[model samples]
Target: MRILLTNDDGFYARGLQTLWQVLAEDETFDVSTVAPENQKSATGHSITLNEPIFVTEQQKKGHKGFAVRGNPADCVKLALQGELIPRPDLVISGINNGPNLGTDVFYSGTVSAAMEGVLLGIPSIAVSLAGYNGDDYEDAARFVHHFLKQNNFIEGGLLNINIPPLPANEWKGVKFTKLGKAVYNNVFEHRLDPRGRSYFWQAGSLAPETDPETDLYALQQEYVSITPMHSDLTDYRKLKI
Candidate 1:
């Protein structure tokens, strides 16, 4: 299988690196990566329009890939439209540093990258580890590798996968889930720069999940969550009414 890998956590992120290493080691898979040169988390599906997008060739763990000076969506766009890499059989964006469960997918560059692939008529997946401040991504990466080898991908399909931070043996197993409500207690800390200019840093804490069938609840229960997604956002129920 020909695979294109990407992430919002930048080219040098351990999560991406571990995933790259795992995928590249497989003889049956041809893998290429094009990721943001710097952290582009929460960038969503935004692409660079007015500015020139730059790409640099980089190597990690003995694997060569491109580093884009743009957002995650831009990386996939350029890689596909510009022919930066050969037309891939699949696009996998992540093994992200943190979970992109529920409504967080709306703001997630990781998921956005995968969505871009789906829009371009390719099968895609976005995988994340359900914790921040954790550097171990072996279990997540291995799961992704196994997932790719076991499943047959269809065009226009996108899967948003979230893995718990525990070892594989500790996992309750994988669950097919739906998006949960991600209610955040948002805060913007007002501050002044050294030049006396005002600025605010955005922060928030997520509320606990209560829905059993949701991705968020699956992670809380130590199960890997797989939520199938699509590009359309139409309210079909309302439309039918």
Candidate 2:
């Protein structure tokens, strides 16, 4: 199988590199990487249509990689259009340095990157390791390999897997969970720069969670959270008659 790998944390991120190293070692599949040149976290599903998007070859230890001058979704978009890798059997985004749980999916470039693959009618997954300074990618990568080995993917959807940063033996095992609520108390903070210009940045803490079966609560419990997220964001249950 040919796997098209992409990530939101720029091309040089360690988490993506760890995933690259892990996936490339599997001789059962061929791997190629295409990712944003700069950080595109929380960039949603933005695609670069008007801009002249191009792909240039990058060589590392005789391995081929592509540095996309666009968002994570743009990289996948360009790849499907014959810019980077050819038609792929699967598209895997991330091994993101942080958790993408609950309402975080609404603004996640990692999930958006995977959703781009869904748009191309290919199976996709967005894998993320909890925390920013995690040194562990084994369980997450293992879970991915096992998941693909065990089941078939949904046709027009993607899976969002958030692995807690814990040793394999310490993991509470994987759970197919639902998205949790994200209550943000302080959405922004005002600050002044050296030049005395006022700017506001997104800075908020997750409020206390209410459900353990949800992704956010599961992560806090040291459980690997797997949510089969669809491209559709519709509230079908709320439709009026």
Candidate number of the best lDDT:
1
Give candidate 2's error at residue 230 in angstroms: 1.0
lDDT of 2 by residue, 43-108 (tens): 988888788866667766656699888989889888888655678889999889898989888899
Q: Model 1 clash pairs?
A: none
Please give, for residues 1-241, the per-residue lDDT of candidate 1 as tens digits: 8999999999999899999999888999999999999999999999999999999999855879999999999999999999999999999998899999999999999999999999999999999998887658998899999988799996458999999988899999999999999999999999999999999999998899999999999999999999999988999999888
Each model's Cα RMSD: 1.2, 1.8
Query: How do all models score by TM-score?
Result: 0.96, 0.92
Error of 2 at 15 (Å): 1.6
What TM-score should be assigned to candidate 2?
A: 0.92
Candidate 1 segments exceeding 4 Å error: none
Clashing pairs in 2: none
* TM-score of candidate 1 against the unseen true structure: 0.96
